[model samples]
Target: MVRAENLIVKAKCFIPIPPNPKNILSLKSTITSLMVDKGFEPENPTISGPTAGDAGVYYTFTACTTDPEGDNVRYQFDWGDGSVTTGWYASGTEVSLSHSWSSSGGYVVRVRARDVYGAWSGWSGLVVVIGEACPYVYAWNGSAYVLDNNVLVESEVSNGSDVEDFYKLEQAMAPYYAGDHFSVYSIMLGEFENEHSFIDMVRLYAVDHDSSVKIALTPDGQILTYSNPNPPVSAVDNYGYDWLSSLSEIDEIYYQGFPGDYLLLDFGSLDVSQAAKLVLRANLEWKKETCIHVQTLNETGEWEDAAILRTRNRWSTIIVDLADYLPNPEGTVKIRLYMTGVHKIDFVGLDTTVEQEYTITEATLFYAEHSESGKVTLKLLKSDDKYAELLPGEQIRLYFILPNKPADKNRSFIIQIEGHYYAIQ
Candidate 1:
C-alpha cells in the first residue's frame, strides 16, 4: 500500500520534466522549408508561341515548376498580360494557359504551382509571345475596251460560204475597216421583173435621190409598192408616174432604209479649215456571192480606184479618214460606193435620220512613231490640215509614184498601212 501511493506522488514530482516543447513550430518550419524547395528554376517563368501582329491571335504558354520531394502537385496560371483567374484542376501536373496579343511584339507570361504540403513551386521559364507580319492589298474600279495588235490584211472568212446568213459583214471586212458602228440591209421585189424595167425605175429614183422612199412587196408576190411619206408627191412619182398607182396597198409601204446602202458619202462638204481630225461613220452590208467597191469621187465626178470589200453575211461600219483624200485643205470631197457582187445596202443616221457632216480645221497628230524597217513619216507641215486624231491601230493608204511608170499605173503603187501609231515621249 505505501509503495503505490508514494509511486504516484513521486511520478508527478519527478517528471516536472518539462513537457516536450510543442511541435507546432517544427511542423510549420517543415512546411515552409518544403515550400521554399518547391521553387522553379526560372522563377515566375512563362513560355509563348507565335501570333500575327496587331491582329488578335492565339498565344500558348506553359508553366513549369518542381518539388524537391516528389509530391502531389497543383498549378496556378497567370497569363500576366492582363487577365486574372486562379484555379486547381483535378489532373494537376502541369499548368497551361492561352492568350492573344493585341499588338506586335514580345510579351511575358507568369505561372506558379504548389504542392499538397503547401509548398509553392517557383515560376516557369519566361516564354516569349512573338508576333507575325501582315500584308496589304489594293483595289480599283471602271471599264475598258481592248483590241489585239495583230493585223490581218485582205483576209477572207474561213467559212464564208457555209454559214453566210449568220456571218457578219463587218467581221468579214474587219481587215479593211474595223470600226465601232456599221450599216447593212436587204431588198426584195414582189415578183421577178425584166432587167430593163428594174434598171429604169432605179435610175428615175436616183434623180431626186435625196428623198427617202419606202418600198414593199405583197406577201403573195403579186404587187410591189412605193411611198414617200414626206413627199412633194411629184418627187415620188416622177420616175414611174403610173408605176406606183398600179400597185396594191401603197400606203402601207415603209421607207426603212440605210444611208450607206444607196448613197455615196460626200465628205467634200466637210469644213476642214479649223478641224484637227475628221471621222466618217458609214454602214455596209455584204453577201457571199457579191463584192462591194469603195471609191472616192473627185470634183469631176470621176471615181478613183476602188477598195474591194467582200463578205458572207452581217453588217459592219466602215471608217475612212479623209486627211489624204482631200485634194485641197478646204474643198468638197466625195465618196463613191458601188456594188459588183450580189450584196445589198442600207443606211441609218446617228441619233436621227438626218445625216450630219462634221468639218475639221485644226487637227492634232495624237501619235507618230516608226520601226526600223525604213521609217515612213508624215510630218505636219500645215496645222490647218489636221486629220490626226485617229487612234492607234487605224488603217490608211500611202500613195507613192514609182519613177518611170505611167501616172495611172504608178499611182497603183498604193501601200496599205495598218494602224500602229505610237506616241512620242
Candidate 2:
C-alpha cells in the first residue's frame, strides 16, 4: 500500500492536474469582461458576400480575441449566401480568408473564430461576391435534342446500339424547302472540328423504315455526297419492275420479225438555277441481236439520234449529255426506243440530267507544208467555222480515223487546230 501511494505521487509529478473549476470560472469571467471592453465578442459570428448574378466574386472574414490564460484559438465563417466554414489562428492577430464567385452578382460573406474554451467571436464585416455571364449552345437531329455544341453529338443510334443512317440536305433547309426546290443545306455541324457555339440542344429523329437514308454530317455541317441507299420501288410492272426477271427465261427463238417496244422518259419540270453538266445513264439487259438507239429533242424541236448501242448477253450502259439535247428544257423529255429480234429489255435507270456549257471559237482548215511523198496529210486550219477553231487557251475535243473510213460517219469529230499544227487536243 505504501509503494502504491508513492507511485501515485510520482505520476502526479509527471502529469499535472488542471486548475480548480471555481478558479477557472473566475478567470474566464474576467477575460470575458476584458473582451467586452475591447469591443470583441466571446462568440465568433460570420457574414458573407452577395448571393447572385454575373459579378463573379466572393469573400470571408476573420476576428481576433484573447483570454487571461492564453489558449489555442479557431475561426468560423458563415457566408450569408448559405455557406459556412471554420479555421484556427493565434490568440490576437488578424485572420483573412477569401473565395471567388462564378457570376456577376452581390453576395455577403462573414467570418468568426473561437477559443479552446468553446468561446466564439462575433462575425466580422461582410464581403461582397460578383459574377459574369457566358454564351450558350444548341444542336438538332431529325427530332429531339441529341446534342449541343457543349455536349457530345452522338451517332444515330437505336436499341442500345449505333445504327447506320443517311441525312438529306433537303431536311436541313426545312420550311425553306418549299421555296427553293434544289437548295442544299448543311445537315451536321462541327464536322470539320469539334468546336461549336451558340446553340442549346440538338434534336435527332429516329429513321424507322429505311435506316439507309440517314446521313452523317461533315465537320462543316455540310451534307456529304455519298448518301446511304434507300431506293424507291414501284407498285406496278410498267415502272421497270419485274423487267429483270422477264429477260431471264428465254427458251424459244421467234423466227418472224419480233414485236418492237419503246419507252418514253419524262424529265419533268425542274428549275435549274445555275449552269451545270448533266449526264443521263441507262442500264439494260438484252439478247445477242438487240440494238438500242437513243434520240433526243433539241432546242429547235427536232428529234436527233443521240446514240446507238449494240449488245449481246450482257448489261450495257448508255450515257447522254442533256445540255447537247435539251434547251432551257421544259416538259417531258421522251426516249423513243426501237427493238428487234424479240429481245427483252430490262432495268432502265434515269438520272436528273446536268448540262455542261462551253464556248467554241472559229477556226481555219489548212494543208500541212511538210509532208512525205505519196502520203496525203490534210491538216485542219483555223477557219471562220464557229465550231471548228481551237481557241488559244481553251481545251478542245478531237477525233481521228485511218484513211480508209467513211467521211460521212466522221462528220462531227473534235480537233484542236493551232497555228501551223493539227493535233488531237
Candidate 3:
C-alpha cells in the first residue's frame, strides 16, 4: 500500500519549466531603459532682487527642473563666495536657497542638478555685484518756521512785526537736484500796506570737498517731539500749517495768530557739505507785517541773518541763493526761522540742495574700450545735461550689475569730468 501511494504522488508531480523568451525580453528592456544616463537640463534659475547689493546681505535663488526618468533629484550650488550647498530635494518642483557673500566683490552664482541615478545636468549661472548701494534721496538746505512768541524776542531779523510773544518752531527743508532753477515765496501784504513783507534770507556755509553729505527729507524732524501736544489749531488748518499728532501724539505741527506775534523755529543740525540752493514757501491771502527771517549759526556760534523774504501774498515760492553760502564741505550746522507779521500762521517750507545719487535712468554713463589690456576710461554722459549739471566733488556711490569676469584689484579705472580732476579713494 505504501509503495502504491508513493507511485501516485510521483505521478502527480511534474518538472518546473523556464520563463518564456518574450517575457524575459520584456523585463530586460524595462531595466535597460531605467539605467540610461539621461536627465533634463534645469531651466535657468532666478534671483529674488536686483542683481546688485551691499555685502553682508543675503540673496535667495530658486530653480525648477525635470528628470527624463522621473527620478528624484538633488541640487548643488556654488555661491561664488567659497560657499556651496549640496542638498537633495524633489524633482519637478520649485526649490529655493539663500546665501550671503562675506566680502564686497563680483560673484558668479552657479547651480546644477543631479538625479537619484547619479546623472547630472548642465550648470546655470548668474552674476551679482556686492558693494555700495546707490541713493537718490532728497537733499536740501531748507527749514520751516512756526512761531509761539510769549515773551520778548531778539533776532538777527532787522524789523519787528509785533514784540510781545516768545516763539518756538521747527525748520524743514526743500530742494531740487537738477539744473540750476529758481523757486519763489510770498507774503500777503494788506492793501500793500507793508510793502517790504518778505520771507527770510538764508545763507549756506561752505562745505568741505571731502566731507560727508546730509540728507533731509520732507518734514525731517519737527520740534513737537520735545514740546507740547494739543497744540493750537485754528479755522485755517488747510492752508498748510497742520499737525495732528504722530499716532500717539507725534503728528504734525503748525502756527497761528494775528500780526505783532512771532515764532522762532530751530531746524536742528544739518551737514551742508554739498548744498546747492535753498527755497521757502507760504500761503497767505492778506498780511499786516509780512516778513520771514532766516538765519544761520556762524562758526563762532553767532546767529546771522542769511535770507529775508519781501513779497505780495498769494501762493509764494522764493529762491534762497546759496551761491555764496554753500559748498560747506565740513561739519553740521544749525539753522533758524523767525516768522511774524501775519494774521494766521499757516505753514512754512524750506528746501536745500545736496549731493544726489547717480542714476542711469535720470542720467547716463559712457565708457571707452579697454585702454590698455586691463584698464578702461569712464565718463558721465552729459549730452542730456543731466550729469553735466552736477558740480565738482558731488559724491556718488555707483553699482554695476553685469556678467562677472576675472578682475584684478591692481587695475584702476579713470573717471574724467569737464571742470575738475578726481582722486580715487
Per-model TM against the reference: 0.21, 0.21, 0.26
Residue-by-residue lDDT tens digits, candidate 2, 279-328: 22222232334355556666776655666543222222223334345433
Model 1 agreement with the true structure over 328-421: per-residue lDDT tens digits: 4235544444555443332311111222222111112222322121222243122222222222112221111112222222110101111111
For candidate 3, the TM-score is 0.26
Task: Please list the Cα RMSD from the true structure of every candidate, rounded to 1 decimal place.
Answer: 34.5, 32.9, 24.4
lDDT per residue for candidate 3 within 1-425, as digits (tens), equals 12122233336677655788987898777555554445343333333333556667787887667766566777777777665655667667777887787765446677777776555777776545455211111112232211111011121123433111111112222221222332221111000011111111111211112213222211211111101111212212223442322112222232444443334332234334444234333433233453655556566666566775432223223345443553322343333444455422334323344443321111122222211222122322222222211111122222121211122211111111222111123
Clashes of each: 38, 85, 63
Candidate 2 achieves a global lDDT of 0.32
Deviation of model 2 at 210, angstroms: 22
Model 2 misplaced stretches (Cα beyond 4 Å): 1-259, 271-290, 299-302, 327-331, 340-343, 353-425
Q: Report the CA-based lDDT of candidate 1 relative to the real structure.
A: 0.29
By the lDDT metric, which is better: model 1 or model 2? Answer: 2
lDDT values for all models: 0.29, 0.32, 0.36
